[model samples]
Every structure is written in C-alpha cells, then in structure tokens.
Target: MPKKDQGLGPSAETPLPGDDTVVCGVVRHLGGDYLLAKCMDGVDRKVRIPGKLRKRVWINEGDIILVGLWDFSPDKGEVVYKYGRNEINKLIEKGFLSKEFINALSEYL
Candidate 1:
C-alpha cells in the first residue's frame, strides 16, 4: 500500500516566473521534439526546452509550465520553468493560476 503523503511526490521550492518575462502555459501536445502549448493569454505556441533546462527538467503533455515568448515571432517560445505539484497548489491558492487549470491538473494526478 502507498503512504497517504507519498502520492504527493517530492517537494521542491522552485520559484515561479515573473509574468513580464515568462507566461504560464499548459502543454497540450508533443509535436515530435517540440511541445505545443496554449498559454493563459489564449495563444497556442510551439515551445522548445532550452539546453540548460533539458538536463534538469522532465516535461510531459498536460503539464503546466512557464514559457518565454520569442521576440521575433509571437507563435514560438522556450520552456523556462516547470511547476511542481506543491508549487502549483500554491499558485492556485495565491490566484496566480486559474481554478480551471487546477481542475484539469487534478484529472491528471
């Protein structure tokens, strides 16, 4: 049997990104090596994980992440941040992330 708290996974306090530099997005699909994300602003963008994050973060479809948009094109971006379960719950409680997103996240968990 699994422990009650064990299902919550590991806890890490990675800081959430500033809205000016990065926006929160939900990973909708994986197009080959790229991630198709729909941002909170209602824009669907193609995102690639930068080399620095590639070695450290593990992203999958339906995960909520932060993406820094490209300067030249509005339709592309880079995944700069990953939100852990604890961080996500905090975001929901703090009103940074919408309640609907949390509902969707619960389906996955």
Candidate 2:
C-alpha cells in the first residue's frame, strides 16, 4: 500500500507579504512570547506572537518571520507568520529576499 497524499508536507504553501503593512523580518532575540526582530525596512520592532499562534508556533533567533505592523505604533507589531528553511530558500530564489539582506542577517546568526 502507498501513503496517501495529504496537504501537510514540505510542499505546503509559503505565504508572501500581502501589503506594505506586512514585511519580512529576522528574529534577533526571544523574550518569552515576544520577539525583537529586525525588519527589511531597517527598523527593529518588538513583536509578539498572538494567542492563536503562541502555542502553535515555536520561533527562535535567526528564523525568518512576517510581521504585521500596528497602526498606532510604528515600533511594535505582531508575528503574522513564520517561514521554514525551505521556504526561506524559495523566497530567495523568487527574488523576494535579496542576497545582501540574507548576508547582513548572517551577522546576527
């Protein structure tokens, strides 16, 4: 017998930033449920993992994430999504992430 094809594999969809409010970031530090991330826009924001994703997602430094900026606070935001290693590579290949950005992020890692 062969295994059934479920939609929960490595080929799972990787979400892209929907608009200007959402941007790519690299986790710089972990403080419990909150994270200090450096975004592509060159801002360091204190972002939190909302209750819906707090228990479901395990984020760590060096991981790539999508942050949804708060309307009232420019320095704060919430974690919208997390990307896997493969997804990161895909983003790079797709031209969503530039090589210079990834190289700069390497210093933190």
Relative to the true structure, how large is the alpha-carbon lDDT of every model? 0.69, 0.77
| Cα lDDT of model 2 by residue, 1-109, tens digit | 9967543334457878766455556556566788888788888889988987776677777778888888889899998788887888888898777768777777877
The lDDT leader among the candidates is: 2
lDDT of 1 by residue, 14-46 (tens): 556574445555556565547777666767788
lDDT of 1: 0.69
Off by over 4 Å in 1: 1-14, 17-19, 22-32, 102-109
- Candidate 2 Cα outliers beyond 4 Å, as residue runs: 1-11, 30-32
Cα deviation in Å at residue 58, candidate 1?
Answer: 1.1
Q: Which window of 10 residues has the lowest lDDT sum in candidate 1?
A: 3-12
TM-score of candidate 1 against the unseen true structure: 0.69
